[model samples]
Target: MEDPARLAALETLRAVRQRDAYANLVLPQMLRDRRITGRDAALATKLTYGSARAQGLLDAVIEACSDRPLSEVDGSALDALRLGTYQLLRTRIPSHAAVASTVDLVRAELGSGIAGFVNAVLRRVAEQDEAAWVDELAPDPDTDPVGNLAFTHAHPRWIAQAFAEALGSRGEPLKLALEADDARPAVHLVARPGEVSADELAAIVGGDVAPYSPYGVHLETGAGDPGDLEPVRERLANVQDEGSQLCALALTRASLEGTDDRWLDLCAGPGGKAALLAALVGLEGGELIAVEKAPHRAELVRKLTSGLPVTVEVTDGRETGFVEGAFDRVLVDAPCTGLGALRRRPEARWRRQPADVGQLTTLQRELLTEALRLVRPGGVVAYVVCSPHLSETVGVVADVARRTGAEQLDTRTLFPEVPDLGDGPHVQLWPHLHGTDAMFCAVLRRPV
Candidate 1:
């Protein structure tokens, strides 16, 4: 009999390979449906996400052991080998059990014809030390720096070069970024402004406390179960990145002071920021209307901040009839290539291609063009992305600002604590510079 957790893990990887599904998206639901819990749930998540993230390295190890090309191997066997190799290289599971269980999984899935092949290959893989295998896989640094970095660090070659070019120093920043991607992401939470203060929620999460903004926490030890925590389930808190919380807070700080107004979250969906903004604006006795294109996602936004003051609508922000100069502030947290969130979304690093950026930029520009009419004269419109890609971040904002008359405001005036937030009309935060998510924000004030 096979461990159900391991079987689920294998099945999840198969889904990712055959269906072009995302591991992060599929695994949570799978785990819930099966009622996998505690250590089993955690290990399942690790096996699924880690195997996906380190597939390139696992491929190298598998290829070294096999006589045939990886493409020639049965898909199920390949995934089984990858999962077994992932355990050996990336996890502390007992080596024999890892190999044996994976072989069993392969035999069960692909029939007995390939079981011996699976066993033989995985046995050879387990026989050699990981360091030796890594050396064999690592490209010569002098001859193929990009390939070397990609293979050794388990990154796509183009992505490795992108980070190298973006970092410029090249001394160690790229390696550090790659290392960060391998680590488990810290759980970040947001306190609903009207319902919970930062101090109250911080105590529950055992995180650092802060006063204003109603959004600060730095849980060190025992991050613990969020659901078991009181504030979160009570609708007084929600999970969100500190960077995203900062972005929403910056908008509130940069908004026109002394005005009771209507605000629009132009591209709100999976509504983390929209919910946080709603709490702030609502506490101030202002209206925050969030517009999401999909009805299902709009319903998620509604459920996420159920008790908070917010109006969720199912409509496309880009084409939604903007009451000419109707809103005091509008936040276009526009869609873009989600390159910045690689650490959180493991499959994203592989799933995204360079071409996706081009398509996303076009949508981003269209949304920005329409967002101009949504904000009132002398009001502010904050354009933000979870990415710091040049084309989507600065290029789109600059293009819209040039076409429209909106003037860029100093971003540091809003997030002074963020050092790389920089002294410019806009701000771009890097994961290397700030522990926060790589995000870009541009505040453009419509002339009064």
Candidate 2:
């Protein structure tokens, strides 16, 4: 019989390959359909996400092993090869078992001829472990250090270049950043204010309190679906990155002169920040107006913030007709290329092209500009993105501030005791430095 776990992983890859479906989104339902749970589910999760994350490295190795070029290989056979190759190189699965399972899966699906082809490729691939393969196949470190590190860490060359550019260093700092960005981050949960403190929630959920945000808790890595946690299902907490929690909290920390109640989350979607903002604002009897362009995501905002004092508006944040100088605090958590949170969304690294930056940065600038216009004088706006790409972070903030004459605030002050922040009027938190998503935040205040 075909292993259900391997079959599930294969189908997940197939969905991703054929439909451009997100692995994270597709795999969960796939698991449910097959009633895969316990260790089998965990293995399936690991293989599916790990294979997708290491696609660059795995494909290079597979092509090296196969006699034919990858473009000529049947797509389904390639998926099986990737799964087998990931197990052989990255996981502890024994080489024979990895090869045998993959061969069996292929024979069941594509018959003997293609199965024989997959078997040959994967067996050749198993001849070298990951480090040996890296030495043989990776770029020459002496001549192309960044490219070499990118290959070792399974990141695309352009992404490594961007990180090298962002860090202002191409040596150890860049390597550490890429290493952390490549690993899976722990699941972080935000304790709903008034409902649970981070300490109380941490104890209940068997997690540790996060170092940065008081509302944040960290579950062990590979804790399975955080939605299955009782606190989350009971509405006492929500899954959010610690970096995101800090950025949203920073908006409230900015010194506002009068009326600190009215707030806005200008690009709130799938509402992680919006829910936290709404809970905090509602404490002081304030209300929040969350704007999302997409109707479906706006509906998600409403569901997540159901009882909170939040109004979900389906409108463009660049022109939310809520009147200018109205809100006391605004969060422009702008849409980005999601370069920062790559570990969480394994497929994103391969899918995002550098060309995506120009379009996203344009939207980011327009959103920040609109946020500045909407905040009352002396009111603060937190311009945020899940990416540390310079164009989306400093470039967007500096350009918008220069044009609007908005005063830039030292964002480090808002993050409080967090260290290794670099010289900053803006803050770029790195995964290596901060153990959080590589979230970037810049605070700007309108002139009174």
Candidate 3:
């Protein structure tokens, strides 16, 4: 029989590629179903995530080594070859062990004929080190720096260009940003106020308080599952990125002049920010309305805010139809391409395409417009996206501000503790700079 860990990884990869499934969601359930735990689970997790993250580079190397085009290769055989090549190029698993184990896996799954082909391709792939293979296969950096960085770092070329464009005049931040995305992100937990403090959550999870967000606790990437923790089960804390927590908190901290008793979270789903916002709103004797278009996600939002002063509604946020001046504060944590969160979801970079941006920006603009309409005059509408793409971040905000004549508030002042924020009325956080997802936040207000 093949190594159980390798078998698990191969199954997870097939699920991701064939079914369009998410690795982060599929892998954990797989581990549970297979009764994998401890070190074996860790190995399987690494194999699955690393192979998914490096799919672009591994396919390039596989094509260089294979006799036929990768498309012509059998589906099962191609997945087996990707597993073997990822091990050969990336992991410290010794040559003889990696090769022998993978050949066994292929033979067990695809029979001897395909196993022979996989063995031959992987042997050729194993002949060179990773850097040498990259140098041979990657585009020339001097002539095509973006393509070079994309191939070398295992990102789509368009995404690399988007990051560079978002950085603007900042010197070569793209490479650093790509490298940060390549690294696995540590899990972050937010201890909801009036429920559990960050310090208390840290003690329970054996984690440290996050530097930027007062509510955040940083845990090691594979420190078991966050759902299994007691705090999470009790809803005292939930899995959240530090940057996301900061974005939600920034909205709460933005100085508004008049009544602040009512708040709206347009497009709130799977309810992380809404949970935090609900807690904060409750503390001030206020109520929060969380609207989501999908019923399943709206159910999740309801579950997350079960005991809080929050009402979850299943309605399209772009057409929420609330009174024009109903809310004192509004948050449009808009639907986005999720480019900022590539590290946490390893397969996302490979799956996303440039065409996705235009559709997402359109929805984002509609949602922001609705959010602005719902807020009272002089009240704040915090526009946030888990993306740093220029079009999605500033372009959406600028166009909306211009069309509505909303005043853009300087967001840097809201988070006075954060450093190196650049010249911004809007705030863009980076994984390399902020140790958080590339969340973008801009606070806009209707004229009184």
Candidate 4:
């Protein structure tokens, strides 16, 4: 029989590659189906995520080791090779054990012929330490810094360029940001206002208080499924990034001169920000309208904001049809490339392409335009995205401000506690800097 943990990881990788499934979503279900539990489950999770996150680098290494070009390798055989290479280079497993066990797994899944090929390639792979292989295979950092950083850090070159561009002057800061994208992100829980305090939730869950977000707690890895926690199960707190919590809080914290009661979450699907916003509005004796275009996601929004002063609407944010100047606050947490949260969604870097940006920025502009329309004069519109790509962050904000004649408020003042915020009427949070997702926010107000 195949080693269950390794087998589970291989199967999860296959699902991600073949079916376009999300590793984080597919791995848990695969483990449960296979009855993989305890230390074995943890091992499976690590192997799966580590292998998926390092696919680009692993493939480069495999191409170097294989007799034939990577294109000639069969899909199943390629996945097995990737799995074995990841274990050899990334894990502490001895080369002999990593090779022998991977050979066994390949034989069980893909037959002796492919197993022989997998064994030969992986043996060559095991001969080099990870850094040695990286040095041998990675593009020169001096001439091709973007490509070098991409391979070394397991991101696409475009993504590395995006981060570097966002960082401006580079060296350590750019390197640190790229490295952080590859690291596993800690789970962050938001203690919903009027439901639970961050301290109470942290105590209950044995997590530390998040450094920046008043309502957030950071859980240690392998803290088990957060859904099982009573606070989360009861809707008192839910999984949310500290950056997202801060973005929602910033909207409410920004000083405004008008009646601040009605709120609109323009793209509130999968509802994390909407739930946080709803809880805040509820405390102020206000109501929130959460608009999600997809029916399924709208249902999710409904469940997430249940018992809060929020109404979930299934309508396109670009055409929400809300009365002009009706909302005291509008949140355009627009659909973005999700470049910011790579650690949480390990497979996304490989999935998204540069072309995705053009379409998304178009949608982002539309959503921001609609948000501007909904906010009354003197009311605030928080344009937020889980990305720091200048096009998606500042570009969208700048375009909307120019077109709509909205005043860009200095967003830095709202998060006075956060350090190294850079020059910002718009706030850009980084995973390396703030231990949070690279969420971007710009506060704007229409002329009264």
Best prediction by lDDT: 2
Best of the two (2, 3) by lDDT: 2
lDDT of 2 by residue, 1-448 (tens): 7598999999999988899999999998888878889898999999999999999999999999989999999999999999999999999999999999999999998999999999999989988899999999999999999999999999999999989988998899999998998787899999999889999999999999999998999999887888888999988999999999999999988877789889999999999999999999999999999999999999999988988999999999987787889999999999999989999898889889989999999999999999999999999999999988899999999999999999999999999999999899999999999999999999999999
Indicate whether candidate 2 or candidate 4 has the larger TM-score.
2
Give the alpha-carbon lDDT of every model. 0.79, 0.93, 0.91, 0.90
Write down the worst ten-residue block by lDDT for model 1: 219-228
Clash pairs for candidate 2: none
Can you write out model 1's per-residue Cα lDDT over 14-51, one digit (the tens) per residue? 99899998887788788778888787877888888888
Which of 1 and 3 is the better model by TM-score?
Answer: 3
Model 3 C-alpha lDDT per residue in residues 344-423, reported as the tens digit of each score: 89999988999999999999999998889899999999999999999999999999999999999999988769987888
Model 3 ranges with Cα > 4 A deviation: 169-171
Which ranges of candidate 2 are over 4 A from the true structure? Answer: none
Better of 1 and 4 by lDDT: 4
Prediction 2 global C-alpha lDDT? 0.93
Question: For this target, which candidate reaches the highest TM-score against the unseen true structure?
Answer: 2
